[model samples]
Target: MQSTSNYLWLLSDILGQGATASVFKARRKQTGDHYAVKVFNHISYLRPYEVQMREFEMLRKLNHKNIVKLFGVEELGSTKQKVLVMEYCAGGSLLNVLEKSENAFGLSELEFLIVMECVVAGMNQLRENGVVHRDIKPGNIMRVVGEEGQSVYKLTDFGAARVLEDDEQFMSLYGTEEYLHPDMYERAVLHKPQTKKYGVTVDLWSIGVTFYQAASGRLPFIPFGGPRKNKEMMHKITTEKPKGMIAGVQHRENGPVEWSEELPVTCRLSEGLKLLLVPILANILEADQSRCWGFDQFFAEANDILHRTVIHIFSLQQAVIHKVYIHSYNTINVFMDAISQQTNIPAPGHELIYEGHSLELDLVQQVNVVPKTTEERPIILVSKDPMTPIGITYKEPDIPMFPPKFDLINDANLAKVVTSAVHQLLRITNSLMKCQDFILRGVYWMLAILKEECRKTTQQVTALNVKLNFCKDTWMIIQKINSLLPQMNLTEVGDVHVKLQSTEDFLMSISQNVQKSQKQLDLITAEWSKSNDIHHKDNIIGKVQVLLDKVSAIYHQLKKDRMRMKLQYNEEQIHKFEKIKMGIHAKKVLVLVRDDCVQKYHKLLTSVKDWMRTACDIRKLLGPIGEQVKNLNQNLENCEASLNKTLDHCSSKLHDEEQIVTKLTASTAHLDQKCFEMVIGMKQLKQEMEDISQELQKNNMIIQSGFQEA
Candidate 1:
């Protein structure tokens, strides 16, 4: 036991090590209470007294659940070495957790959320106390397991932290290089002479980089070589942006930024989470300090996510998964409203099923939903409308196996036994043939339904494209007319024009998406035509599902764009502009165009709902067909083997061998005829699918012509 002046503690194990200090797990002799003792090394003692005391002062002043609580400073008994004792965190540092193989791709969403909440709370406390933690990284964050075995993260290691106001500038270089702000990075890593002082916003950059790494398991910016080997290249990539370069990401030093808004494939976050998180990252990771969001906005955005009730929803009819973010206190109706907005389906007509039981909307709340839900077991949404077909669930049926051997037989009863075995084999094959025929009919019907829905959806998309073009042209005209009006308020006009331009770009994007969807639909149809095996059909169904999800995403974006445009085109603004002759005409035309767009959008939503229903029905039908195909093939093989074995045995044992052999051969030939017929039916079904694809193309052309005429 190592005794201090007033306390006795045994240093059991080393917890961590750094350049200037080493922390050890220590226990008190009296109560056996555990604590972490951070002992300063020779290097730390050489620092200026004020610089060393800054950490102890900061730790003493801060008090929060998310910040590590500081115990007292103590001295070793005989050696008289000074040490700082603090609350012990059993779960270790967050860096240790992140380094685990299970978290190689990053922490799970729930765990990441916990980290975000704790870090934000701790940082908010720092802001309140007017302190800056210069070194804020994963290594400095410690995790403590709660009574319920949940992780609670707290900030520690304030060695580089100091008291600094929001506007105060610090000239001292600190923080890990990879997470440093560009200005700091230039001085710290590139060895460039930097005269500018860093403000509190530097922490925001570190937080951004840390959060991004926690989610993606890798740094955002990387040079062709590596972060350390190509420090100058990283500096250039961080500071310089060529045309068309994406912010905060550079795979190669001088190369253009990759053209993707998505996180890396290694990221474990869901699409819905990425949607909410990426915007925050964009605001915080800005190289320009003037543009970066302060802690206030960061807290607001992060808290909004933390406080929400997160649940994954799987639409059984659409065969798509969606993530819903809502207030925990909200009822199921509110949750359904969010789902409706995402899916473009009516809220009243949704029936949520969980764990094989229908959830009572009036009795359940969003808070209760999350605890019972998981990624593998999301709440299932079923359509309540009677007209909607209920999807058929499939289970593999038990297939009977042939007996390993025949019962004991003699030459006297050989003919009787052989005849019975041949008849049994024939019956089994006949049953399989009938089952195959039934599955084939179901496949054909579902395909026809899918084809009709695809045709309707394609036409609706075409009509939407035409309407969006008209709206764009009218907005352009409005911009021109508003510019020419001498009486127009230039600032107000400018804001509206910016909104209009944004809407125009969005509309253009929608047009491109529509064209892409059309091509995807055609490809799916072509694939369906060529599909003969169950696995091939499954792939085709998945493609259709992906296309539906894309359309739903477009629908939601359109709704948002329309609302913004409507708000910008306020009645008062229109009346004010209507005084001029040209302005009056263009303003009225714009109003007409907006109304037309709303109507078209609603129609598109209806088409999408119908399309999802049909596609789901096709998938449901395919499931059972796949099962039947496997069973039929297995039984056919068994029957053929049994028949051949019986014939060989009877020929060797029976006096009338030729007659018995001839009868068995006839039965085998008859079974083959049935299989041939089933194959022919499948070929015919393929031909019909090809015909449907042709008709879809022809209908698309007609639909375009009608839209142009309108």
Candidate 2:
């Protein structure tokens, strides 16, 4: 057992152990809060002092939600050895999660996304601070349950991390053999006699390996025995280029490289997501340093997947209510078209109903559909043709209508009319209240969705910018190559130039679409805040409609722009550009450039298509809800107007009664005064009579007294 100044660490509380340090789950004596205490062993001190202090300095300087936070350093009481007190992640490392039998093939789509989001965010934080985590693997990443019970991954173990710029080089070898870059592996593991320096892109390689591991159960590059026993083979596998862009795995020491572009069959990620994810893995896991994507491109592509809207449509016409995945954008029409292709249902002959409201084909999915949809609650498809049987009976909405009419002909009907009017008013008011609450909730939901969209768009824009930067760099290289080798017949340079120019144009167009999306999101955010001040039900509905309209317009335009770019990309002679015969040096550089451009362009196009598809589903889901809100608002307004008119008519009828009551009140007042005067006179007469009777009684009493005296 080791005791720090404020913590107690026992041998039984060991969380994990590495070569240099042992992490122990400890508790603070003062607050009793659990913390992870990392105690470095003497092996760690064997390194240079600066190297030993690197982790502490990095942890102290860095503060991000996705990065493990460092508390104050403490000295082990008995040995006076410095130990790091850090935030404890109860969910443990990502390796533990992957080690589970259920996750043998890979994490589920949701879990994978969570891992991607957290790891990317952590890496982004590291990048922002000009730090490179030389060793990024599943074991180094920790997971903690958030307040909402969602798994939040954090980057831990900065022992191998350092403050290095993107272009800076380091010769020190670090990282797990399986996750290390090919150059790093050649130098460190194989002990190759080369002075090759590693750059910041090394972290990307590790991330690629980690993410690939998370997506699929096994590592990308595996030899017959293992990475450790067959080190040279592993290096060869990592360095060699297969026939196609895919991961390589060898079954034997001298066996051929087995290239696979698809994930394992047991992977829990949907086929739709896999399609988007495979390309990302292919690009990131590229052994060729020149071909591997930068952190920016990786983040963008991953975020694009994260932001994708995958809608599960339930076919009510089917016997068992089968669910199908439809990736679409623009409107419900597109969604139906996709469904039509998948299910062979005529798009025009069927209606899509979600939560009882029939979705319009022309309505945008993102604005009107996605917010209200969930896996459990899918969009219900029903056949409109009477002969075709819908498996589940589609019931009409049971919305009640209220129309109050005032009848002021007689007094008997007055009370009835008032009561009916009041009841109708109450119902309308209650409905309006409910509608208002729904509107508020809808606005918040839309805000959340749009904010996510904005984040996705921002990532896309950043990626495009990165691609633009890459294009510029490649162009500069080309220009230099041309300048230096004036006599070299680089005929392929012209095609490369044209391709780069077109790629730039495509990237710019996508960037503009992203900007438009951001602007629309800003408008929605503004409207959401403004919605609080809008008291009128009709006005609120109108505001929401306008916001949806603007969103729909922008999305349609984006879809058009994407289509145009895709067309332009398709029309290009990519095959002609692929065949380049020139000087060996020039050939390699130009081929790399061409391949990079093609790969990035395809990825961008795929991302855009995925985004648009998601946007459409989201809009379609939201459209019916928006229409409901409008209908509810209209009903509320009609009821309110009718109630007001009835009350007005009743008020007019009561005006005559009010005048008649005034006349009667005046007449009663005069009668009351006269009756008071008559009562006074009667009272005075009675008093006089009483006085006479009293006098008579007194005289009688006096006579009685005289008689008594006689």
Candidate 3:
């Protein structure tokens, strides 16, 4: 029965149960090293041996830390099952982190990037080996705790991965529908052959979705109505644009917290974060031919996007107007210059107002902007002048009498500013926490990368070391070879010298390249560490310190303002109390009157006045609420109609352009074919001309010889 107590894998509790196989945690019988064992039943799988053998071959070839390492594969007689042994990943699947922390927290950009780097590295390796992972969902990505107490993510579950051929059979849609590309779903619906080829872009699409959710804690598309309601999800994936969800979404009538404009609750997104994500998402999700990001393009473009900063610029005329967007870092003077260019207002005449006062150009360095995903940073707003095309006017240069206050309203402004500052502090706290967690992950990934590069360098160093010794030996041998000239040919001595020089040059080149690689590694590590600290420690500390002073100043002002407000409130309360006392006195006297009396009438009037005041207070709260609702309605209408119209126009234009491109491509091909034919004919004509010239030259030679004889 091929059963023995000395069997290597001791399968314990089941880790997962899939349709084709059941995975379990195992330990090596001799070594005690932990591993994962996937047992596939012979009956359940089609061509079981073929599949297992193929998987084993691919897994065995893949030597990557990010990819799961295969130890061995075997078949059991009793169970008639194919068992695949793999490295045990203790840190669990990424899905656990995503789903478990739904309420608590989300994967920060640094953390997500760390995971992404691992996944991409693994994928790149697999691609280099001519293999494709059809399934790359979060569940298939797992974290493995290494001996160094560091967690490194790895791409696991190669059951769906296959070696795709260029001119032969390629990948099938053998993955989860949710993570599948829209094209994959379309092909499935069309009942395309399983042998049809699909590119690695399917993985890119899933990566985009994963990135979107990781960064925002929200799905790019709603995970509902899958294949139901006339394949609504499929339709959405194939045709509809991804309508990104709003966080802090509230639904109407105490329903589920789903995102909708009707709910009137909007998630505030940072203008910068939005700008950062839009291009990335466009690369993956946008099905445009020219602008889409290929696999190589992702790595190329990500570094620039990671380092660049985003800023929102505003214009001021009669009212404050938002009009400009700037990328990367710039000083206030530069920003002012940008505004000048955009608004045609000279930088000298116009002043930049922040809070309730003009910003001191000199203190611009102190005003640091920290990029946040949720926070919509309010930049300096231009003052209360109506802007017009011909509205350039020079104001007399004068010193400001009062410093600008930042808030529009006095009491609430201080409270709002203080609240916002507190939120910033909270975000800093969260980011710090995430940084600590992500740093470990980053270190592990960095270590893995270093190990690979250093291994190659070590090999070169070893070779060079050996060659150095060889050169010394060869110098001794060269003297021997020279002496051997008496015994044999000395010509071999030059060959030996030339070979030695070539070897020396080769060693020098390798050494130089290795040094260059080390410098590159230094740059890479520095950049990685800097990116990991997205909100730099110094910046955060400085921001907190600035906000602390601002908050404290506002607190003192708020205290004074509260005192003044309380005094006014107290005076009104005293008047109301006096009126109430009069009303009470009149109420007692009401029994004495029985009929309509002036005192009894005064009580009724007091009751009416109290009701009016309460109503007014209610109105004050609802007034802003009503305005917001009205604006939301207007926005919804305009956005829906305008966006739809714009998209339709763009779609039509794209279609027309595609047709034109197709026509141009065909004409170009025809022209190229004609050019090729003409080139061939021209070559033949040139050959003939050459032959004719050669004959003329021979005849001239003959004629010249005859003349010489005469």
Candidate 4:
């Protein structure tokens, strides 16, 4: 067994003790190299030698610039203490530094960048090597003074390190209370913490927490009140938003003291540096793990920042080598100056007669540029591939698949009006064609006659501000004649009233449908007023005029129907008078006249009912057609827009494809030139070698001839 004095001389002093091992300050017996030695008690205490060996194997594999280096391990037979030797950091852990240096590291921009790069680089290497230092905290980070001006940081404590390459479960009370993630805390609370199958990303998250604390001078998360406040604080770390209050507002009103606010930065940094640090801190402290930047991305960004800093500091390539300047502008101002000096294809709706073929030239696009100085701008030119066949198919853009129009008419009331009008027209037309009975034929003819009369009335009604007084006066005159000539009647008044009421109700039922149709027409007119299609505007205008004429015809028809019905009333009155005036029981002409007047009134009512039904039918047809015209206008506009988009997409793609073809052609030309030169060089070299061989042979022949003569 090794003597106690032999190892005692190596230890600086006892530092602390824990459940598994006791820590001591140790030095090399000969070289006086200082180290922290953690000696585990016995084989009984560490029965799972396999687990310890696995951990030791992982720690030994970690050879990062920032990680603490392992020295040696010894087994003391007598004491059965497994001893681990490591390089000692005299400046102590980050926690000790925080306590001594007043809250945190007051690092400047360059210094912070340097430290951050070192930390990220170390962690990145660890992750790449498939190792995870699960227990990352301020207590594990050790700052050591370097030779002269160099400052170095060491990431110590690999006892909690795990190799993720293994499929085995890794569970242990492995991390400090203040650095565990919320998930880790919950698991610990349940006593079923995930000890295995955890990844290196977890280690990265812990490091991010460490960074947040270091930058802001205080922990990002802190608990208000709890028995084990530090443990609660760690749970709050990655979950809660830090209430960054002033220094004086640290304590809670009804709870224990949480953390102080973010301590002020003593490190005077520039705006660029502040911007850089703030985002990093925010990312580090983000609650969502997915949001946090991965170690690879973080290091890449850090490397770029560091390179930019270096460039700024060094200020390389400041002087110009060779300078040339020129200013030129067009001088010609002749009237015959060509516009753009570019070829023009025929506009849309025109045929391009090319190479004996009648080709369609669609004006798919147009562009206008307003340059600052027209004289300075270069003239644009038109170009095309000379080799392409005239009849070759040009590609077009794909059509976008969108929902059907009229699906937008979501109001039930409007839909009913539209559908009802269309269906009623269909029903009326079908009934007129299919009905075969004599009564049905007479009814149909009467309805047709009433519609024709109403059409004449509509002409007068739709005219500018024409009053109904003329029609009223004519009816009054007819009534007076019936009264004076023994043709007036007053019976059947109830039937007249019932027929009038029915006509009024039908009119009322269709009032909204008529108004809706009018509104849609008005909207179309308003849209056209703003902008019109250059080619088809006049055609649409003509169609609108035809529609207006149809409406006027229907309006005049209604007016004529009203006038004819009044005439019919007069005829009915005359017939009733003939019956009542004669008395039929021998000469009661007075009573007969009164009965005739009643019949005339009933006839007027019947005519009005028939006229009203015809008017309703006319309005229904007009309303739906008006709606159809409006819908067609909207669809045309949508088609125009979609066509414009298609044109743009096709143009862009064609331009890109042309550029690729140009590049390929250039490459092919270069290769052809190179091959030609190589062929010429080979011919020249072959001729030169032949000449040399001939000269050598001639010299040998001369020597042999000379020797033979001698």
Q: Give the per-residue Cα lDDT of candidate 2 at 514.
A: 51
Order of all candidates by lDDT, from best down to worst?
A: 2, 1, 3, 4
Q: Give the candidate number with the greatest TM-score.
A: 1
Model 4 agreement with the true structure over 388-490: per-residue lDDT tens digits: 1111011211112212221212222222222222222222222212211111222233334334433433332222011112222222333332333232342
Report lDDT (CA) for all predictions: 0.60, 0.61, 0.49, 0.42
Candidate 2, 379: how far from true, in Å?
2.9
Per residue, candidate 2 scores C-alpha lDDT tens digits across 1-710 of 77887999788899999899999999999988999999999898899999999999999999999999999898898777779999999999999998653465678778998999899889999999999999999999999999999999999999999999877889998888889999989988888798877788888888878988998777988888988989988888888856335467888668887878877654556555666778887887777777788878888987876665667565443311332334434466666666676456787766565555555544455323544566555566544332222222111112122123211122112222222222222222333333333333333443455556545544533443443343344444334433433543445344544554555565465556555656655655565455444433333233323333333333333334434454344333331121111112222323332354224323333332333334344454333533333343343334333333333333343344445545665677364564454444434433543453354345435533432332
Query: RMSDs, each prediction?
Result: 35.2, 37.0, 37.4, 44.9
Residue 133 CA error for candidate 1 (Å)?
0.5
Error of 3 at 437 (Å): 23
Error of 2 at 392 (Å): 22
For every model shown, what is its TM-score relative to the native structure? 0.52, 0.51, 0.41, 0.38
TM-score of model 4 vs. true structure: 0.38
Between prediction 1 and prediction 4, which has the larger TM-score? Answer: 1
